[model samples]
Target: MIPAPFDYARAGSVEEAISLLGSDPDAKVLAGGHSLLPAMRLRIARPSMLVDIGRIADLSYVREDGDRIAIGALTRHHDVANAEVLQQLCPIVAHAAGQIGDPQVRHMGTIGGSVAHGDPAGDLPSVLLALDAGFVAQGPTGTRTVAATGFFTSLFETALAPDEVLTEIRVPKATAGWSFMKFQRRAQDWAVVGVSAVRANGGVHVGLTNMGLTPLRAVGVEEAVGGGADPASAAARADEGTAPPDDAFGSAEYRRQLVKVLVRRALEEALP
Candidate 1:
């Protein structure tokens, strides 16, 4: 079905986009149109205005900032996959991006849009949570930083205000041990369960995907790992805090079981 008619405007800059959004409460920012457009066409999302920001080319690059890497909001999945810096410093993101969707979706979906959308099943969110990235939002007042740990409040919900636009993501530099494991019934389907891990200094962090209302870190497992538990023993705590949902695809119990198995596999790969 065709999407409902909507007004369109291409913002020359992020400030322009923010102004546009500020002008209309129901206005939506169109980054790459990969997620928003599909939702619109299916009537799942009905914004009165489409503020196209894809042409705001200035916000579409990757750079190093001190010990962290700053990725512009409009950076496409393919760009991140091809980024040598991310591959060297945060390969887990690249690996997860490579596994996001088929080539077409990856070719157009913006990283900022994906993270801002706050889909618990999306690979990027869980990876960012595991990496403890920071999201930067710009608005009429000024810019503010939000931690990935609390950015996502629930499925399809975020801490962003209506007048604000996410402009960039910051990932701390770390060439540490990490792993990303996902289980999907089909190649392009959302993960039944996914896990991301990163080892730092002396401990490991593990984040669960599609397991709860939001991307969740398996902190219990991390605590165990920190306390010198064997990988096998630590992974046993993967579902200690998660409450997976039951659906047509699989039961909640099945997802919890998958979390245990996937987390175990990811921990083994992340262990030094």
Candidate 2:
């Protein structure tokens, strides 16, 4: 399948990308294009123009900022998976990133693109959610930060405005007990059910992938854990507030059960 014809403009900076997006309501920003290109190829997205920001070299970095690790929007998955700061401070993020797709996809896919794409099944969103990360967005007016808890709105949708470009992701330095579990049928395949668990703020944060319309926090499990429930007991509530999809991959019931097992394992690993 071929994407519908569209005009293209390469943006040299975040400001220029935002301007290009603002110039046409139908314009779409192109980062790594891992998510957008697939949708375009299937004609699910038919933007009138593509604001390519791939050449914006400044947006590809991973650095330490105070107690947080700042990752530029254009930082590729490969880089995120191998960044020394992320590897040491937030190993869950690096571990999950290293599991996304294949080598080619990892080298080309950007962390910002994955998060901004807002796919419920994406590995990073759930990891970021579990980490309670912050996303920096630059729009025509100015820049603002959105918490991970509020970043994802719905399936394939996020809080980012049409004219806003995600600039950086900030995650706290979480070097304590953490675990990322992804269950897939084959290597490089999307997760059938994924769980990200991290010890934070004296409690456990749990994020579920492929369990809802958006990357969802396992509030039920978290509450159970907070209430002194054991890993097995807490994980029993993994499917309490989820709407898992019934597809070829697995039925909603299967995912519901799988999440319990995965969450239990993740909690066991992530909890002291």
Candidate 3:
């Protein structure tokens, strides 16, 4: 299938991108275009205009900002995978980013684009949720911070407004002892069940991807573990609040069970 014909424009700055999007309701921002372009090619999505932000080179960096790690929106997965700073500061995100699509996709997909897409199956959303990451967005109104948990709303939906552009991601640097595990039918496929666990502030945070309508935090499981529940017992609550969809790979019941198993395994891995 061929994508619908659309006007194209390169945005030189964040302000320019925001203004472009605000000028047209049917415009879409292009980062690496890994996820958006495929949908466009299939005609599953059609836009009147495309505001290409790939040319805005400033939106691609990883820096230490006080107690937080600041990630520019256009940072590629390959960059994250190979960064010595990420290796020492947040190994889980680096490791998970490496496990994203194949090498080509990693080189082309950006962290901001993946998380901003708000796919329940994407790895970064769940990991960022577990790490309590914050997103920074700029719009005509102003810039504001959105916590990761509040950023993901539904399937392919996000907190980003039509005229807003996500500029950066902020995650606490104090997180340690993190583990990311995804169970897929094959390599380079979306996870049937994925878990991101990290130790923070004397408690545990766990996030579930592909186990619900949105990337969800396993609040019950976290509380159980923090309350002294054994790994098996805590993991039993992994599916307490999920609504997984049934598809070619697995059913809701099957996914719930997988969540339990994987959460238990991940908890053991992170806590050990």
Best by TM-score: 2
> Is 2 or 3 the stronger prediction by TM-score?
2
Q: By descending TM-score, how would the candidates be arranged?
A: 2, 3, 1
Q: On a 0 to 100 scale, what is the lDDT of residue 67 in model 1? A: 91
User: Every model's Cα RMSD, please?
Assistant: 1.1, 0.6, 1.0
Query: What ranges in model 3 sit over 4 Å off?
Result: none
- Error of model 2, residue 63, in angstroms: 0.8
Q: Give the least accurate 10-residue stretch of model 2, judged by summed lDDT.
A: 88-97
lDDT of 2 by residue, 200-245 (tens): 8878999999999999999999999999999999999999989999
| Candidate 3: residue pairs that collide | none
Question: All candidates' TM-scores?
Answer: 0.97, 0.99, 0.98
Model 3 error, position 82 (Å): 1.4
By lDDT, who's the top model here?
A: 2
- Pairs with backbone N, CA or C atoms under 3 Å apart (clashes), candidate 2: none
Residues 110-159, candidate 1: write the lDDT tens digits: 99999888888889999999889999999999999999988999878999
* lDDT (10s digit) by residue, model 3, range 45-79: 89999999997999999988887889999999999
